[model samples]
Target: MNDFTPSRRSFLAGSAAAGASLVIGLNAKGALAAGHDGALVPNPFVKIAPDGTVTVIIKHFEMGQGTTTGLATLVAEEMDADWDALQIEFAPADASKYANTLFGMQGTGGSTAMANSYMQYRQAGAAARAMLMEAASLEWAVRASEITIDKGVVRHGDVSAGFGELVGKVKETAEPPSEPILKEPKDFKLIGQDLLPRKDTPAKTDGTAIFAMDVAPEGAIYAVMARAPRFGGTVASLDDSAALEVPGVSAVKETPKGVVVYATDTWAAMQGRDALSIEWDFSNAEGRSTEEMEAEYAAALDGDGPVARDDAGVAEALETGTAVEAEFDFPFLAHAPMETMNCVVQAKDGKVHIWDGSQFPTVTQMAVGAVTGVGPENTSIETVYAGGSFGRRANMDSDYHVEAAMAAIALGTDQPVKLVWTREDDVRGGYYRPMVKHRVKMAVGADGKLAAWQSDVASKSIFTGTPMEEMIVHDGVDHSTVEGVSDTQYAIPAMKVSVRNMETPVPVLWWRSVGHSHSGYAMEVAMDMAAEAAGADPVAFREELLAGSPRLLGVLKLAAEKAGWGNDLPDGWGRGVAVHPSFNSYVAQVAEVSTDADGRVKLERIVAAVDCGVAVNPDVIRAQVEGAIGYGLSHAMRQKITLDSGEVVQSNFPDYEPLRINDMPKIEVHIVASAEAPTGIGEPGLPPAAPAVANAIFAATGKRIMRLPMVDAGVEFA
Candidate 1:
């Protein structure tokens, strides 16, 4: 066996664990009994048991993003371990043990799990592999390099040892590799391969998946809240006599913002809340309609707002008789995940425990701990599967989680009480995407090259009143609202971008793609307009303007080539293109659309090219791209949430409809292979779709669409 020497520190670390107690148990006669111990490990990603079983604990909650599978891929790749023999489990509430490397909290959002934890998990796998290899080498009396590993077996020519047989001899004497040699792309056997279905897919499809709503502890009660109709409004008084008369109605409590109705079941709680008579104090400031907010935003554009980006001599370029100006309007939007907002909490013995399908568990735990005067460590958060969270589950203040915890504490109930918000409640809830207005002015030189560009955006700051309000905004300009506009790819000599943060009584939060959603639309549409004014094809014009950006130009050319950009189409069909670079990745899209005789818009196909660099799983990346296209088309065609006197006009699917199957277009995705590090894919596909469709609309009808929900503006597809 090779002499595997250990450092003094490693030996001392192992010696310190000599007093640790190990427990082993068996269920029936031969059935395996799950082991549980109070002792916690710092890196709980993997645990080796005495019985030859390997358990991998995942910290992030899975919500259809395939995080569990992706994390496992990282572990398996570095460990050179047998994937079929590994067992996966969810980690317990231990923030210190599994702190997020990116945000320093135990949560999942921003499409960061795979990209941030890739190396960390790989190192974990390498550590375990080293220990196992050393043990096997010792047993066989051969050098570690002579022992080849495959399918959980270490072999030396005629001799072989299973990982289970070597576990007892494999002392934990190996240190994590500081710079482990990562596997080459060509050597990846399972990462990009389409393996079997995900571990949770069957359970989810069969309705056996345990979401927060399905988590009902024994003797648990239910509660429904009647929040203020207008945000920031408070409840004056509640007449609970009618609610008490209902069968199974238990009690009603008045909270800071509203009244909570407690009952035996969810139906009873909802019915009791409906029966209660409550008066709201909205006299301080009546809520304004969406139209009023849009007008205010439009008026704010005329004022001198904070300049996010300004180049020298933009005014002189505008006066050079080559300037073009246009305006774009983006409406407010809702997350509208499949599962509504819900949280189950139980507060007792100076401690609080919560089971929630939240994206920001650490944030929720901290918020609950601070409000109830409990220690942060004492607050336990159990994450469940979220049906969907497009940045909705990671609210800045943990509004839903705090409200649920407060309700449970106020009730003083030993049983866990779940607070469920109805679909209507979710729709009218405070947080929403801010309505924005964009004014863009650009100049093209005599050579048909982009010379100067100017843009001003007016919108309510999403972070103004949140925890990150102070960190992201400087001099009254919210950087989130002008991200894509300020960092555009064109090689303009002079440019200026301003953002006006308009104050609104309504609450606003981050939606999918965040500021890039509106900024990309404005930028791309403005580019298309400039191209049209210069009497050039959109694809060729963008290529000319992108002379300084080879990466963006490459993707644009690929997308155009894939979509047959220069080829002729049907008489009524037209093509449009858009490109956006965000989150360190570049994406380009070409949309083919046609309008029927009745003016109905029909999106025939979409060609997307992405340069995200070395996709770990190309199929999944393509799926995300297709999904983004569908979502973008929904918003472009008919998805919007309007308000009338602080009340949401569209409540359900009948009005706030998503894209139907017939409305979906055929999508083709192309990935540009590179040796560079991988970038994000979840949100990169979103920014290009809206402008591509809008540009196509202009091509069909010779009309410029400045507003969203194209159907509302008499935009016909034919």
Candidate 2:
């Protein structure tokens, strides 16, 4: 990634040498800052070289979301920058320069990369194009209006100049206009166009993508941390004599939390780690056993908790009417990204450099700097393409990266180290989606209309003790546990949603779609139960309840139509539908399933419809939907993290199963055409998927499954 951004600011072009190339830096507001020498410090987001090469510095990590290419399209569309001239690079860690507008930090999560940076990146390109026009106006002595730029060229009557030739006019001395003209959607050239291939795909296919594990800085040593078997357990004491004698092993250092083995390669490091033995300590173990935690949640559900939403008539309606109640138990789920946690760190002269596939670069920089005693400003972080994140990489604790920095500090600067976690370690690592239980009770009237709904969610709070506790949690209630239920789309007459934020020593972090992961399954499947009791078609029932939200209704209708809702199927096969809105996007899903004679539920197909507004790249949209389906299905089927005596029982894929590619159901995605601004597409497709399958299983066998790892209810593929 040749670091240059001449588009967002006045870009300087030159060779790699600091003295050879012109340098400029800018602040987060797109204004230039002064370098150490008092010269102009450039804050470059895009670079246009004299050779006509356009490079976009991606602020968000490409965590298999296609955001890298999607973002590039926004810039190219607005600037009329030639797609053939485009390239991409990871932005350096500088929160003041690349803070995600949604979070005021340099990171990518909450499915906000495209949503938050949508207008920001567009403005960058629009401003860059304006800067070029200002330069062309001066170079040709023509009014800025007379200077028409199109397809990488600026033309004034017969006098025309290619962007490469005119870009130099925006020299190190040229100043960009205070205000830049922007293009309307109708005038878009590349946005919403699907012909262009994803910029990341070619590199990924060619095996040239730069993932954190692939980064091997000069003289880099591989490290494997022998982390505590129990959450929050420390290193206690280590006997590394055997580890140090291992072949290629350099050092066995103790970090604040773990023992790090430094070796020539990952295998050597692992071997060294395996050879080490230590005094085991569980006296400081933070978590109780999974059984005890589940009992606590169950008790909390039966007791009282914080009320997130309440409406009149709930008690009166539900007390007098026939009702259906179900208790759903959802286990804690590990993120289990295909690429395990890894970070490369090097420290020198009170300055630190970090290379990681981090979802939070600003946090990573600060955390790593703080641990290394270098401070945030002295840390340089390069966000690399992540193999897979879901939500594992975006931790409030900065867990993995911080441990890497600790190891680097122990190794004593100058020894660049790559901290790697094997799949076993990652699976056993904490910070899973909180262990939760949902007790939902819904009542319907004789008129076939919904009368009342009440939901109680008991779970470990993802925000409880973290730095974000005060900002989000209120009055003993955590929104993450009740998000989908509190703001449910159903138009019930009375509703009450509450959460019991059961304190658990088990670490918890936001998984894909956060609260919607469990709440979606609970609410959507419970609606199906209500529909069954009312003897109404599921789709029609949802339609009646969603009169206030036409967008969600529209998606539901679309999915139903695409799936042939009323069509007959073979014996033992049934169709089930579900709809939910989260992350500002509406999604509806239809699952086709069949129960085998042996009582295994096999999902045949899924029809998903989404209204995410303007589709920047339709291919990426479909990919996201399909990927979300796979991920959601994995959890719904049989993915769970269990602990015995405060230790994770599941170690790797063998036990903590991920949905295999061969087992994935056929998914058909339909994107609703809309001219509105784009919303989130990343996690919106997941929430509706699980309940759709669960509902389909219910339709097939008349069984009401109200628990996660629906396989627990005897569901699986042949």
For residue 591, model 1's alpha carbon misses the true position, in angstroms, by 0.9
**What lDDT, from 0 to 1, does candidate 2 have?**
0.81
- Candidate 2's clash total is 10
Expressed as tens digits, the lDDT of each residue in 1-718 for candidate 1 is 1111223343233223222211111112212112244211113476666555566677677776777666776667666667777666666655555555555556677667666666667666655566677778888888988877776677889988776677666433333333445667687766666543465666789998889878898788899899887776778877999999889889999876478899999899999998999988877644789888888888888888899989998888788837799988888887888888898888888888889876876667667776666755678888878888778888856778777877786787767888998888887764778888999998877877777899989988886655455567877778889988887888778999998888766667887788998888999989998897787889988898798998899999999999998899887777889999877788999998888887777898899999987666677778778887888788888878877887668776778788899989889999998767666777789889989988877786677778887876778543
Model 2: residues with Cα > 4 Å off, grouped in runs: 1-43, 141-143, 171-174, 286-288
Question: Could you tell me which residue pairs clash in candidate 2?
Answer: 5-46, 6-11, 6-46, 24-41, 24-42, 25-41, 25-42, 25-43, 26-42, 26-43
| lDDT by residue for model 2 (404-461), tens | 8888878875778899999999888757898889998888898987899999888878
RMSD of each: 8.0, 6.1
Q: Model 1: how far is 133 from its true place, Å?
A: 1.2
Error of 1 at 401 (Å): 0.8
